[model samples]
Target: MEGMTDAPESQKRALRAELRERRRIRTASEREREGTALTQHLIDLTSDLGARSIAAYLSLPEEPGTRDFVEWACENGIRVLIPVSRADGLLDWAPYDGSDEDEDLLGMPTPTSELLGPIAINSVDLIVVPAASVDRTGMRLGWGRGYFDKTLGSMENCPPVYAVIFDDELVDSVPSERHDQRVDGVVTPSGIVAF
Candidate 1:
């Protein structure tokens, strides 16, 4: 029964590999179309939550794109805080510059502004995070990196956290552990659902 309850690490690795392959094969046009829809989903969500300040990410080409939503937030006068990678494997925050030119080494687009430090995440009204996959229980599987995990765990007065992923990335279950923080909801190209 214990074996049936949680997937082994091997199973999770295999699922990650499969999903990576799928993302690799997806075309740019397809990703753009999906991004457009996802932008709307995020917009509606921000409205319903009355989020004036949002913590979100700049996506890679393969990930569910959040550039549109980030730009929208900036245009609409919503304070947008993006992450900067830190040497300690934690993330620091910076305001989005609403530019198409800035990016970090990992191909993750970033802002070229003064970093507001890690604790700045606590000030946001909502969080939109990237995920390799998320289960029905809102368990997010990251790329074996504990950055988001640490971020979510450290917040004392945390806001609602949502994992942003492509449509098929939301699955039945993902391997879970004591340190893995669950999200409040998920945002896909199709729609949104809270866990």
Candidate 2:
């Protein structure tokens, strides 16, 4: 039983290491191709869901595919909330209206205009998370940061969690610890996978 328990953990660590190496070699063209595919998949996933309020990440330069989803969400009548960094490594969310130019916020690109309204995480109907990698079971490896995990932990009746990743980045498994938060779904270039 002890060995059985350790096996998964060992596998997770190895997987994480492998993914990190792969990401290091990923080219811009690859990211752009995958981003285009993933954006289309996301559009298909939420097009008819009737979601009123959504929480989504503002993509960085390395993750350039997020703008499409943001534009789609705004056009579809979903109120979009994006995370703003606070002093305590905590995130406070504000609405994203999609018209503002990009500004640097907490090392990530965010909207420059004050077009957001404050809201709690639990109030969101859906959440789209950024991931370094994801697996079939919906586990995600973030950028070695626990911000999303801690934020999700504080919510009750939280909406479904979806990890957004490029198609090639989706693997069969990933490294996860006890503090890791598992997603309910994964959005890839191919499709939305529900776990």
Task: Indicate which candidate wins on TM-score.
Answer: 1
Clashing pairs in 1: none
- For model 2, where is the 10-residue window of minimal lDDT? 110-119
Q: Which lDDT tens digits does candidate 2 get at residues 1-195?
A: 898768756776676677667766779888878888888877766664656888898786666377888888888788888877665767777678887655444666565645443346678788888887887877777775578888877677888888887677778877677877888888877778889
lDDT of 1 at 142: 85
**Candidate 2 off by > 4 Å:** 1-28, 101-105, 112-119
Candidate 2 contains a number of clashing pairs equal to 0
- List lDDT for all candidates, in order: 0.88, 0.75
- Native-referenced Cα lDDT, model 2: 0.75
Choose the strongest candidate by lDDT.
1
RMSD of every prediction: 2.8, 3.9
How well does candidate 1 score on lDDT at residue 130?
A: 89
Q: What is the lDDT of candidate 1?
A: 0.88
Candidate 1 segments exceeding 4 Å error: 1-7, 105-107
